[model samples]
Target chain A: MMDILSRLNNYTTIVVALGAAVLGMISGVIGSYSVIRKQSLIGDGVSHSALPGVVLAFMMTGNKSTEVLLLGALVAGILAAGFIIGIVKNSRIKFDSALALVMSVFFGTGLVLLSIVQKTPDSAQAGLSRFIFGQVSAILKRDVYIMTIVSAVLILLVILFWKEFKLFSFDPEYAHTLGFKPMRLNLLLMLMTVFTIIIGLQTVGVILMSAMLIAPGVAARQWTDRLWLMIVLSAVFGAGAGVIGAFSSSLAEKLPTGPAIVVVISIIVLISILIAPNRGLISKALRRRKSKKGWLEKGVKGGDII
Target chain B: MNPQLEIQLIAIFIATACALPGVFLVLRKMTMMSDSISHTTLLGIVLAFFIVHDLSSPFLVVGAAAMGVITVWLTESLHKTKLVSEDSSIGIVFPLLFSIAVILISKYAGSVHLDSDSVLEGDLVSAPFYRLELFGVSIGAKYIYISLFYLILNIVLIAVFFKELKVSAFDPMLASVLGFSPILLHYGLMSLVSITAVGAFEAVGSILVIAFMAGPPVTAYLLTDDLKKMLFISGGMGALNAVLGFQLARFFDVSISGAMAVMTGVTFLIVFIFAPQRGLISIALRRKRQKLSFGMLNLLIHLLSHENSEYETREAEHCSLANHLHWHEGYARKIVDKLIIEKLIVVENGILKLTDTGRTYTSNEYSKIFNN
Candidate 1:
């Protein structure tokens, strides 16, 4: 029992999980747009890209403040986004192909940089590779404060841009006709995504941050069609998962919390996917089976659309 | 004795296997699903490792592949339900499986050797250590042999059913009537994707493996439109990127995975901006030239107009020759310049004259317009 308490008391683990909750909220909010835009994989792309930023930040400032590291993450994340956009706009590359191309290249650069960092003699900071796979157990209080501030800022920005984002998302041509610039709006949205993603690096790390960003939104979407509600629910669900995962991992020793919280959020998302109200798999299958039976029982009417 | 040379072969081998079937994946628009499959296979790996009790066991890889296929199956099956979309279905299913895998690793295997770090970092440093021995003579790394077998399997499958696969990818509904089972081809491709994904796990980790599967083929598709060109270009791009990327990664002393991804992006960008007709610079220049030529036509129209015609005026009323306004100042000048270019117009005292050749050309066009 004492072992459990001691493990739980490791402030890093709790801080890490709490930080994940904050990141999860921000990711959940942004991920809704990503999913609706059919860019669920962009999360995966940006997550891997964040690695170079972390390493570069460490190399320059030697102060791994969540701020400096986040700056690195923001720069790299935005560049990756620009690369994807460039591929789509400038090349004949299909959207999926462009996303894939950008994802791999950014991830490759991060990996190469990590290898060099690891080889730098007498540098303990080179061990940031562990951060790549997500060892959130080392998250400190300052990290949590930063994450919280970032999350708050993200939520505030979303509120401010809610109307603009909605118009830009579903009807870019219409938005243009109404004098709203799609490019400018999209740039802002992508920037917000960068800030949120950068803050998320400490908890989910470079590899799985996108997963965290996208999963909760996916789950919450299953439960609602309303965009506002979806974002709110996703944030709540993501935070809940973080709390649960951290609490559980705290029961054991050596269980890295980043992966742990991600796992929990994933499970929550799965539950929603499997059985959420109108969008759940079981409900749909059941509806399909019922409809098939109904059609078999009743003669097909010429006017019946159902 | 040269590490670089030995690694280059390894890079070539991986890229060949990756690009071979990646051609089909890009065509199928299933690259995203393949990526999800790679991630969800983590559950398969963890569960397999747990069951088989060893990470190095062949069963671990096999288990992971099986899980990958299962993910594809589950995602596809669930996607057909009206409740959600394909992307959402994938988003929901695999992350949960992967998360469960992570939870399991934390609970049961926290003290065990396997962890997320090992999974994501991959066993690249140690991959060369695992050799495949044939009749007491080591052939190569076991992964090399395994991946080669998978590669050959993919090649044979592609060869045997090229026509069917092409038809299905281009138009599944039509392919269905032609007695080609698109579902069968789909499953086959998904299985191949899974095999490539799980097999490369040790060499480059799951994310890089997915990158190899999707990135190069995607880049190739951009440069070529023909199916055959796509296949060739995709494979060529993959092989080229892998070799250069691996070396760059090694040289930069960074993780191999990150460097490999960056090189893929850079290559695609270079092709995008400078490649012949489709490249950015060329396309922009072509547009500029088109606009300039168009502007010159407008200038000619203004020049040939009647002195009082004011047709170039932004808010001018219709011409008195409106019925014949098809030959307005803009049209007259356009006609004259076009005639001159066609060797039909001549200048006498700064006044335009239509040569016989110009008259004939104008007659045909005027007749067509009048008739219309």
Candidate 2:
């Protein structure tokens, strides 16, 4: 523990952990909305599709600035979302099919562009491929600041539209009847999912980023029925996982930070599923057993009286 | 066989192999399952590697295929809990397994020949070098044989269980009542998906394996309604995508697998837009034509109803048609001109008249519409 704490005193470790924590917190909050709304896999689609944007940003600017690259990722992610929506809306294809098709195709395009970037003889391209698996240890102090600000704005938007989002998520038809446009709210929520995914692309990378988006919400859901509490608990879980994952990966050698974060969040989800109050597997089983015992005792007494 | 030819053959076989199970996946609305299974299979390969200490062992495929089924089973279990949605369940399970695989690879197997990058981004260009040798005789690439084995396995299984798969996919309850085990069929199909993913991932990568599995089947789905025709069309689409993707990569000197995925997407888009019956363009054109004909029908019906009525001058005039029909002037004029071109309606002294053909069409359509 002391060794881990001492390592956190390192400047690079602190920056990476901070960035990851902020990313985890916002993704958790937004991810709860997505999970409840049954749009969990959109995160997966958006993250994979963001790769092309990252590569394109690098190619156009010839630099690896986090802001510019992420901007590119945001554009590509939205465009991919558009493709998914368009496909599902216009054709007989279902949502999952469109997502899988769009996600793979976009990632493939990114890979092609990445190959092109590699042959350009630019030394900056060396760091570009890291976006695939992500190396959070390479995140600069500046990147963390940007991530924090963007995440703050996202959280603010969530707060401002909390009641509307809750309504739309739980009962979209009812929300529509109540004068809220479900389509507009859904689009807003999807944009949040896309932005949260874009911000986390550098921290958890594209492939495993979906876990970060999904696991916390799932874990928090096991502990609470209220939407606000679920959101808060999810954010806490996400931040905890991010910090621990970043710290542990930093402490060890050869452990990639993105996978480390995913592993940590997944563990949280597992434990939450097994033991959280009310809805957990063990708790539910225990309650069932108690009810059965109570019923048996009452039945025996009634038989004696008869 | 030549190296380039071997590569193309491997791609074609892999594409077809993926498409076989892919048809069911698309039909079952479980296309994302392939995406999840493809990622989780890495853990199987890694665990199998640790046991055999060999990268080329057949156990890897078995282990990967098992892991794929486990992924489906786990996701279903989580969904059964009712705490999380099905998509969330899949989103959670696969990444956990894949993360463990990645962590294991980086921590213990870092020194080994295994790496996640090569698994996610397969090198089809070097596939020809993994040649198969049998009893001092050399054959084509080893991948060609592996993929061919999988292709044949898929074809045979799908052929033998066509009825069961079709029934279960369309309606699980009906299939179960008919004495076919839904559990067995579901797992059997999942197992096929896993094995196909493993077989194809060597050349196309795990991610693009989804493209090979989903893209062609979906495109074929837009073109046909029959199950057998869909399967055949999907297979043909897979083969066509492989050839086109190869040529594209050759022209651009890019990654063949990536190029293949792009081609798969491009082909799907083209088919999505231009399919004869179901394409977006055809659907829109059909809608437009229907709108025009409906307008002409309305015009004819109106003129016939008021031919000698007192309101004929009031309602059937060319200028008054817009008010009666609630159409914008431009749209009214456009359809009116279309009717004139088709000899459906004639304008005489500011009054509208229906030709004999137009009158017959209107009466027939009116009866057809009312009967329906």
Candidate 3:
């Protein structure tokens, strides 16, 4: 363990691990609101929509800076969110249909742009495809610093507006009555969500970023009922998964880091759903068995109630 | 057959196959579940390949079908806990399974022929090269046959159990009372989706499969209210999209599946805006028409109620309508002109009065508005 720690003390592993951990925590913190609002799939929609932004940014700038690409992704993701809201409000289409439409169209357009870039006689476009399935080892130390700053700002904002967000997530109408502008708050949350998704695009890719948003919140929900506690727990779980996944992927040869992190978080969620005290499957099953045994001992037949 | 024609045929067949089950998914508000199932089936294909050591093994189909059911089951189970929502469960489950498959593929890229690119965006241009041979005879593309088989199976299933499916989709309680298990039918339909999804996975990637599955059904949904018509229209729309999307790809010299998915969205967009009854334009038009008629009726009722009042009589001129109703003068004039054209009102010596026809209409409108 000491030798492994010393080996991982190198600059690259530490930076990658820290970057993944920050991404995981930010995703968890922002994802809690979306999950509680029952808009979890919007993360999926936003992440997929960011693909075109990345490509367009590269095309326009003729450079592969992470900041430029992420800014482009932010613009595209916000537009996609607006498009979804417009469709849902202006037409008879439901939320899911709007989500599916924006996701597929944006991703498809991204593919078209990517193919165009690939067909061009420029070798610089080689690494652009790696955004689909992210290569964490390729992340430089500067990218880690950007991730750290973004995540710190996100966490600080979440802490600052905790009450308003809680009300917005739990009861928007009541929040409106209390003089809070739910729509503006919603837009803010969505903007933050888009930012979180864009920053993680270099690490988790578009396809699997939704998992990072969902799994941590899901796993933490099993352990608590309070909103604040759930958020804290979710961040911890997400960070733990990130560290473990990064470590294991580094130890194993040819194991991609993003999926490894996602798989780790998923295992955490699976265990939480199965073994958590009151909400878990096993505990519920055990309680049912106890009730059945109690009924039998009291001379009550199974069909008596029916 | 020409390779282009063969590709179009495969595209159409795949679209039609997906659309059959897709109608049910759209109606039941489970279109996102199909997305989850398609992604999770990647793990199924990987596991099946590892076990059977062949990409063409029938067990891959079985394994993928089973995985689809498992995907639905896990999502439903998580949903049943009341801890996570239905969409969250889906968001959680499929990515986990899909990521595992992706990790496995990357870890063992040497031994396995599967790549993430093919899994996400399939090579329809090369689909024709993988031909199926049967008994020393050359068949068409293997995916074409596979899609055809599933399409027929889906048609037969829907035909035989139309009533059950209809009942379960619209009202599962009624289905249960009528001795039809909605759960059983749900799993059965999910299995068919799984099978169809796997068949199309190699021809069109998982993303396009989702577009093909949901797009045509939703487009048809905007055009019709009848389920039977919805199914038929969606199938036709799917076929049409396939051909048009192929032409579009050729025109642009871009990725075929990406072009196909875009065309699917384009088709839906056209229907969304232009469908006769349920479209955005129509709905807006209907609302505008209702507002105009409602304004005219209100004017007639106001005249009828205040015919003998001295103050109303003093303000009963054609120009007074703008003040009486607080509307713009042009809008008031337009409404007055339309009412006069309908012979519901008349202006005599600058005092407006409801005609005999207008009096009866106002009373009827009054009763309709208040009595209901």
Q: What is the DockQ of each candidate?
A: 0.46, 0.72, 0.59
Colliding residue pairs in candidate 2: none
DockQ of candidate 1 relative to the true structure: 0.46
Q: Give the alpha carbon lDDT tens digit for every residue of B245-298 in model 3.
A: 889888888777778778888888888889899888998999989989988987
CAPRI-style quality class for the chain A–B interface of candidate 2: medium
Q: Point out where model 2 deviates above 4 Å.
A: A1-4, A171-183, A251-255, A290-306, B299-313, B338-372
RMSD of 2: 2.6
- What is the TM-score of candidate 2? 0.93
Candidate 1: misplaced stretches above 4 Å? A1-18, A206-208, A251-256, A263-267, A270-306, B1-4, B121-144, B246-260, B297-372
Ordering by lDDT: 2, 3, 1
Worst 10 residues of 2 chain B by lDDT: B293-302
Cα lDDT of model 2 by residue, B7-46, tens digit: 8998999999898899999999899999999999999999
Measured by TM-score, how close is model 3 to the native structure?
0.92
lDDT of 1 by residue, B1-372 (tens): 244555566666676678868777777777777678778788888888888787668888788888988998888876776545666667666766776787788778877787656666565655566677889997766655665676677678778888988898889999999998888888877887788777776677776776788877776776778888877787788778877777776675666655666677778777777877788889999997775555444333433343235542321223322224344466445544655686755665454445676556556655664688
- Reference-based lDDT, residue B85, model 3: 85
TM-score of the second chain, each candidate in turn, equals 0.81, 0.94, 0.94
